[model samples]
Target: MKINTYIDHTILKATATVDDIKQLCKEAKEHHFYAVCVNGYYVALAESELMQTDIKIAAVVGFPLGATSSYIKVEEAKHCIDQGAHEIDMVLNVGLLKSGGYQKIIEEDIRAVKKAIGNNVLKVIFENCYLTTEEKKIACKLSLNAGADFIKTSTGFGTGGATLEDVQLMINEVHGSVKIKASGGIRDLNTAKQYIDLGVSRIGTSSGIQIVNPT
Candidate 1:
């Protein structure tokens, strides 16, 4: 398979600079990656650098922690969209979801972000490292019901990243209605291929170059 096509070349570090974004865009173009995932601040820069190319720009919302209010996440998503982000990878309200008392709030938060982004792609990050199996399944259902286009595994900055078992459980719960993205810890060809082979529509990682040209 053309693995590059499945990759969302990413760099969401807090310390990422303008030069870093420029280099990311350049590498993505050279490798023909599916997209370049960046922080909200760099969405426009990446867009500018990637203009005239098919490479997409994905922005993260609510970041590693999903504790912020739904309104804030929605606004952040809208701002990113206005800045030319073609896709949004938003962190789910992990605290609320884990509490198990605010299930409706979690769903509404995702729905609000999805609504703000309109037809643009929306991927909800579950940050599975902080969730239980039941919580993960619940998160998948909530994201699907909230109109998310994809269900992502982690933020890559979380306590842990995506795992095969988690991906399998996500696929089982999503049932193809909503696509899956296995981010975090996917740093090599074999790992990326494993997730793709499991039917994930996208792979989010900072190792696109390594995976494509491991030698």
Candidate 2:
């Protein structure tokens, strides 16, 4: 399989600078990645740098922590789209999910954000590291019910990254309704391919180059 098409080249570190984003876009252009995932503040910069390319710009909302109010996440999603973000990877409100409030709140929050962005792709990050098997299933169900385009495995800033078990569980739960994005600890070609084999439609990693060229 062509690995480039499955990758979402990512750079979400707080220390990332303009030069870093520039280099990111350059690498993404060279590798022909499916998209370049970045912070909201850099959406415009990344868009400008990738204007001539077919690469899509993905902006993060609620980021590593999903505790922000739903209204704030909606605003963040809207602003990112305004800045030319073609897709959004948004963090789910972990607290709400864990508090037993998920059933009522989770799907609505995702639907609201998806509606705000119009036709832009929406990938909901479950931050699976903190969830139990049952909780993960619940989150995936909520995401699908909310009409999210993809259900992501992790935020990468969480206590842990994506695992085979998590990916399997998510895929099994979501069935074939929504696509899956495996993020977090996908650092090399083997790991990347493993996720692909498990049926992940997208791989989110800062190690895109290493995975693409493991020499």
Candidate 3:
């Protein structure tokens, strides 16, 4: 399989700068990775840098924390799309999920963004590290119901990262209606392959080059 194409070459650190984003686009082009994932602020810059190339730009909304109001998240998604982000990786409202009985609010939140983006890809980040198995499954269902294109594993800013068990559970949970993206703590070729082998359609990592060329 073409592992490079499966990668969403990412840089979401709060300290990221213009030069850093330029370098990220540089590596993504050199590696021919599928996309360059950045925070909302850099979507336009990434779009400019990757303009002539086939590389897609994916941006994060509500970022590492999913506690933002739906209005704010929706506005952020819209702004990113306006700035040329081809896809959005949005954090699910984990607080609401854990709080329980906020299922409709959570689903509506996703739907609102989906509606705003309209046909652009939406990958719901479950941040599985903080969730129980059932909670993960519930998030998967909510994403699918809200018309998500992919179900993502983590924000990488969470206490933990992706695990095979979580990926497998998500796989079964979606039943192939939506695609899967495994992110966080995936730093090597073998690990990337393991997730790919298990049917993840995308790998979100900062170590794209290292995964392709370890030496």
Per-residue accuracy of model 1 over 130-173 as CA lDDT, tens digit each: 99999998999999999999999999988899999999999999
Q: Number of clashing pairs, model 2?
A: 0
Q: Model 3: how far is 166 from its true place, Å?
A: 0.3
lDDT of each: 0.94, 0.94, 0.95
lDDT of candidate 2 over 1-215, digit per residue (tens): 99999999999999999999999999999999999999999999999999988999999999888888889999999999999999999999998888885586878999999999988899999999899888899999889989999999999998999999999998889788999999999999999999999899999999999999998
Per-prediction CA RMSD (Å): 0.7, 0.7, 0.6
Colliding residue pairs in candidate 2? none
The residue-by-residue lDDT of candidate 3 on 56-101, one tens digit each, is: 9999999989889999999999999999999999999998999989
Candidate number achieving the greatest lDDT relative to the actual structure: 3
